[model samples]
Target: MPFISQIERQSDYSRFSSSTPIVIDNGGSYFRIGWAGEDDPRVVFRNIVQRPRHKTTGETVTVVGDHNPALLRYFDCTRSGPRSAFDGNVVYQFEIMEYILDFGFDRLGADQSQIDHPVLINECPCNPNQSRCRMAELLFESYGVSSIAYGVDAAFSYKYNQKKGICASNGLAICSGFMSSHAIPFVNGEPVFEACCRTNVGGYHVTDYLKQLLSLKYPHHSTKLTWEKVEDLKMENCYIAPDYASEVKIFQKGDKEAEEKTRCWQLPWTPAPVEEQPSEEEIARKAERKERQGQRLREMAEAKRTSRINELENEIRGLDFLVKQLEHVPENDVPAFLRDTGYASKQEIESNLAKATQSLRKAKGEQVENEEKGDTSNAEKYNLLHVPDEMLTSEQLRDKKRQLFLKSTAEARQRAKQRKLEQELEREKQMKLEEAKRLENPELYLDLLRAKYQELSEKVEQRKRQKTNGNNTNGKQNGSGGVGRGERLNAAQRERMRLLASAAFDRGKGEDTFGRDDEDWQLYKLMSRDNNDDEDDNEADLARVSARLREIDPTFVPKSETGSPAEPPGFRPLTKEDFQILMGVERFRCPEVLFHPNLIGIEQAGLGEMAGISLRRLPSNDEALEERITKSIFLTGGSCQYPGMIERLETEIRMLRPCGSAINIVRAYDPILDAWRGASQYASDMQLFQQQTFSRDDYFEKGEDWLRGYKFRYTLT
Candidate 1:
């Protein structure tokens, strides 16, 4: 069953007699307090305290234990986390502890000038005397309690259970509490403190260990692994495996039974909506719209061209009329006629007619056929190209030179076309041969393809290395030595370092002849940035292989742009699985420390050893006493609730006992609340009034030393 706090403030505090003592089980995990002789605690809460400044008021408020997380938004809690009074299961910080006690007592209906009733508080075993003294002083000075009694919570629990008839008067009490676990022998209904053992491990360590392992395994989900949530998970799913090695083997081999044992948590995820393909009718409409747009553009261009051609033709006719008029009026009148027609002379008018004719031809979309014309008019345009220079005029000589230039350009174009055609045929033949080989044995062909891809990939990788190496060298050549201070390079970058060092040292040695020749300049060019393309061919080959593999293997994926093989560093997204913290070994591992205190880095005897230690501490070493103690080994405390805890303790204690000694280990009826209940019942006794010694004089005479050594007789009340 999951444990929960009972925090409703008691209303009948004033009704209880003034002599009735208040009992508190102040543990590291929880704080429980109630009137003596009650069957249950009146108030219980987490032992933690928080001090947060109110968001609106900016005043620090003491919040004792866990509350609604949403309400915490009104306070700034980033500077400080929730604090506890305990330091390794012992109360070392009195300030925080005082605040908690104040809250506990206040909620218990303490409205008087001071707490006038007697108080009973639980403390850890072997608590430092300084801490105990401070606690006593605080109660005396501030709260003004009439009297105080200090007792161990585990021992109280053990005694409470013994009275309940759960165990004999003499037995072993293995109490695994919040921050620590202990085993004490109850000899004749009294605890043997000197022989008691403690192990500094409990539920806290178990929860922490599970949280760490889960967070490390699923970094993405770490945010959800809150301490509180992990605690819940630890209590819910965690259990002890009798044998860790054998249990792990079940999971390691992935047995069917292991699958049944394994649990999974599905995180909230919604797949992204996929895009739907456009409808046929929609696609047709789009195509039609595009075609209509193209038609309109074409029509607009044609109209513009027609208008230009008409303007050119009109200008040509006007120019022709002016030329005709000039021919009739003679050469002297030609300039006047040309000027009226926007032409300088007859030659100008002729040039205008020729330009208009060319415009008209282009507007009609007819090829100007300059290259074809050059071929057809070869003899007429460049007649002197075949003739000797001695028989030609200077004008003819220039024409022959122009023809020679045209002929060479046409020859170059023809050669390029032929080469391209031949290369295309060669590629087609190679592709057909590869296809035939694939048809022969598809599986083998795929294997070969994969092998080829791997080879090509390696080559490309090597080439990349070479390029990077070359860059490093060039950087060094530019006098930028050894990369950056903290920069690391792949294998190629390191090789470049070696090359650069060799090149640098090789210079100026037996060679004052460094730049004596032009070849030395070429050496610099070889080492230049542009010369880093040593693996271009290898890259091209890889590209081809990758393309071929993609064609054959449906599963083959080419990683180039976004799928580069580089892992990102740092936290990823958390899943529900991360929120699911499982504890298999942790359940026993935590409580196991009760039998082996060394597990939690604590060098102390465990619970089993503590029983023996307590017996050894006894003033009496009688065999009958030992047997009586072994007969009533009572288990108590919150931690004793584990399934096989009682049996394990019995087995361990029996081992330490004599060959035929009788041993019994029993669990308390209500280990968590029995101590407070028992104390409450004791306080209700009218005789308790006689034990109450109040006033400042009694405390003053008692002194701090006497308060430090104060012990309670639970059975007396």
Candidate 2:
């Protein structure tokens, strides 16, 4: 398992004396703080901080190190994720560093206004003078430390292991830490910074590469690949391969061994509930209920029709009685009688009676036969149409024009009816022909029909794609050509635009004769918004083809228009494969970067090459010194905990050394905590601190230049 925080406030902080130094292993990935001479750090946590706004209070609060993720529910963490103080293994942001230090010291049970103990902290190899000075100032001014000592983390691990008899006085320490890797050569029980080589590739690069590859491979699950989760996965599964290329080949071939090596992380998923199919009885019940509702509506409509028919019949009787009374009365009295009946004349009364009779028949569900009677009177209806207008009076001439218009309208109606009949007959004949062809060779006929349908569908779809500038398969349109300055136009639209442009610019040019030609005037009509005949024709053709395809092909499914509703989620049952995150080649591929920095686009030499480069940079050209360095090669740091690291590094270093050179690879007792353990052990010695550390007053007098040259000797007695 990856390291967890040991942040329980120590209750016995007052028990330790003031002279005792507090040792802190301020590594890139984690922070470890404890009293000197302790086996393990009393307080350890991730070196990160987050300032999230409280959800309920709307106040931004500082949260240092890793906390229970459940408690973060009260804060809106979107504004700031977990931020580290280091940038490429160097502390550049002091504000974040101060927060980390405060948390570390608080967890170590510091209750006073300021810490009163001497502090010993770790720094990177060949750290910048500015960084070193700023750190010293922070400790001396902010924390009120009396004195401080800075030492390399790898050198501490090397010294700690040397005291434990893990390596000799002259050896190589290959410490692969969080952000970078280092190969430090130790001489006479002290680290030689001149001979050390640093490669900017380490655990951080490995985890980042793994996270990126997994995210790219499974974009849907990219949100699930959190940094902490990926770190845990790396520690659990990733191992340095004995032979990267060969091991990759084994997975590439997909053998049983590869299957055994592959790990799977199943995400949270629940199966979708299945819908139960209704039984015959349930379907029948629903149909019966619908039938009862329809029957009740029909009865209501029948009752309404009967009532309307009776009322119409009564109106017709009253109108007929009024017309009969008008005929019985004298011509002078008939006018007064018709006025009481709301009619102008006897003919008007008759017309009212006929309309009421026809309405009554219609209400009773009987046809009136009005169209047949009207057709029979066609000769009499157009009698005035045959008469010449010159022979008629003014009123007669108006009647004659009306009769002529009625005759022409009747003729057009008859022609339209005849054309509709002919079309129906033609369609029936064509369907019969298709049916006969299908009967003769059903398979071939189906194939031909399918091919025709596909062709027409593609043609229509291609036109749509061209008009909308959309993808045919995905149906996504490009927004670039949408109505603006550089917008695309169709052929006719382009021509109209060209005409408009010409008309606007032609006046200033030597072409003032725009309206002189008839064609120039026609340009105005083409540029008008009414020019849409081609678009209408294309739409008609597309609709006709689509209808024909739908009628002939039983399996044809039309494409949905854009912005339609997508399929509902849980449409398909959840499967195991959907949740399973497989680790096949990624298991070893991530860690392989240690031996090949170029894999992650880093130009620097890898861990293996750094060893040889470090030996080359040594001052002595003696082969015996080089042999001793190789013989006691030490692997120390968090990254050295990978399963096959020792074997891989041994094989890698052997290739770079001379033939038959005795090489011994040793691992630190606890690669991760040994650095802090070594620092704690070294700080416990009171004489060593007095010899190596500088007081706060001494820091002001010595100046930054002097501080830059200061080095802590690890071989002090």
Candidate 3:
């Protein structure tokens, strides 16, 4: 069963007499306090505190114990996390411990200037003298207590169990607390401190381990794995696998059992709203708007074109009139007539007229028909080509050479057009052949298409790799790009880097003969950055293949858009099972560590081994005493609540004892609170008022060390 804290303030503090002793069970995980003789503690709370700043007021406020989380909405707790007083079962930080003590006493209704009653507080086994003294001093000075008694919490539990006739007077008390585990053997109703064993592993370590593993497994939901929530998860679901490796193997194989074992906790999630497709009216509205915008743009463009055409037409008319006016003049007077205009000569005026007509046709969106125009003026364009060398002067020969160059250029343009027409015919023929093959067998056609696609993709990929390497080399040699210090470069890049470095330092060693030969100029070409742009067509081919595959194969997945080697992992929707941290392996694993500390990270011996160690420490190894202790093996502490704890301990202890030796173990009725109940009952006995319980004078004169040797007589009480 999951443990719940009871920390309600008690109103009957005045009902108890001033001489009544107060019982306090100061455990690492919890604190319980009550008036002497009470069956249960009047006040109990988690042994933790938080100092949070109020959000609205901006003032730091001290909040002790667990409070309503809703009330904490007004506070900003980011700066300070909930802190515990105990460190590995030892109260080290007195400042935090003081706050806890104050909260405990205040809730117990300590209204007087000081507490008038004596106090009985629980402590750990082999309680350090330094820690003991601090506790005594705090109670005496702060609470004004008459006297203080310190006893191991486990021993009190064992004694309480013994009173209920659960076990013999002599037995082992395996007490597992929050941060540590301990095993104490009770001999003749008294605990033997020398025989006690301690292991630095308990409920806290198990919860922390579960928390870390889960956070690593589901990094996206790490914030959900709070310490308190993980603690609850550990208690509710975690369990110890009898055989760890085999149990994990079951999960690894993903059997039905493993499927059943997996639990999920659903986090809050909301479905995204669905987008509705546009209605017919909406589509029509958008189309109308687009058409209107296009009409406006078209009109503006037409106005611009008309303005340009008009300007060109006016300029052509003026040129035509000037040429006509020049034609009216006599041939001998034409040069003088052209001089009146801007023209240098008759030929210059005719050339200006031709240029204006060509520009006007172009502005009007009419094809210039260059080939037709060229053919019509061929005789004039190459007039000197037909003239023989003997029929022309040296100046005429120069003009013939210019005509030959123009004729060759026109032939080259004609040849290029013929090649383009032939390519179009070849593509059409190939399409007909493919259609005939597809008609024979559709499956075979698809297979052939896929094969061709694969071949093209591989060719494109290889070309891309080669181009990338080439670009890296060019970049390295040009000193424009370098790999980061921690990054790795391609092989070509590394080689180019080496060559450039060697060339830089090779300068002063010999005479300058770098570009003496044609081969030497090739080095400049290799190092040039212009070579990197050559792969653009190859990348386009790869994109074509990828698009084709996507159209054909519905299941085909392209490489990641991130360009990384692998895709970044994303979080799947959390189910109820994901949030649940199953305790199958952890249940017994945590409690078992109390028996065998090596299971956890601790190197100390377990409870059973420690019992043997404790027995060996005794001055006299008496068989009867060992037998007595084995008969009354009382289990205690908050952590002794696992289902199979009694059976597991009994079996382990039996293995340690001699073959025929008797062994017995029993659990307390209420391991968590029985210590406080036992203390309260003991303090309430009237005969407990001995002279040793003492006057105030005895405490002052004897000093603190005198209080260290103080022992309680439980049998008398």
Task: Write down the lDDT that model 3 would get.
Answer: 0.72
Question: In model 3, which regions exceed 4 Å deviation?
Answer: 1-10, 54-58, 71-78, 242-253, 271-592, 660-662, 689-696
Best candidate (score: TM-score): 2
Per-residue lDDT, model 3, residue 520, is 67
| TM-score (all chains, Cα) for each model | 0.68, 0.75, 0.68
Per-residue accuracy of model 3 over 591-660 as CA lDDT, tens digit each = 4566656665778876667667766666578988887777767777666666666676666677788888
Root mean square deviation (Cα) for candidate 1: 9.9
Error of 2 at 137 (Å): 0.5
* Alpha-carbon lDDT, every model: 0.71, 0.84, 0.72
The digit string of per-residue lDDT tens for model 2 on 1-717 reads 111234577888999998899999999999999999989999888889888887888877777777877777878999888899998888989989988888888888885358889899999999998998889888888888878999899989988989899989999999999999999998888888999999999999999999999998889999999999999999999999999999999999998999999999999988777789999999999999999999999999999988898899889878877766767899778778877877765655665676788888887778788876574356555667768778899988888889888888989998999999998899799878988998899889878766765666566556566556634333544565343322333467667777777885585485556776777767787578556656566566556655755776677665654446876777666687898889989999999998898899998988888999999999989899999888899999998899999899889889998889999999998899999989999999998777888788797887656787788899877
Which runs of model 2 end up more than 4 angstroms from their true locations? 1-6, 277-363, 367-370, 376-414, 426-571
The C-alpha RMSD of each candidate to the native structure, in angstroms, is 9.9, 8.8, 9.6
Model 1 off-target regions past 4 Å? 1-9, 260-604, 616-619, 689-695
**Winner of 2 and 3 under TM-score:** 2
Ranking by lDDT: 2, 3, 1
Cα displacement (Å) at residue 228, model 3: 1.0
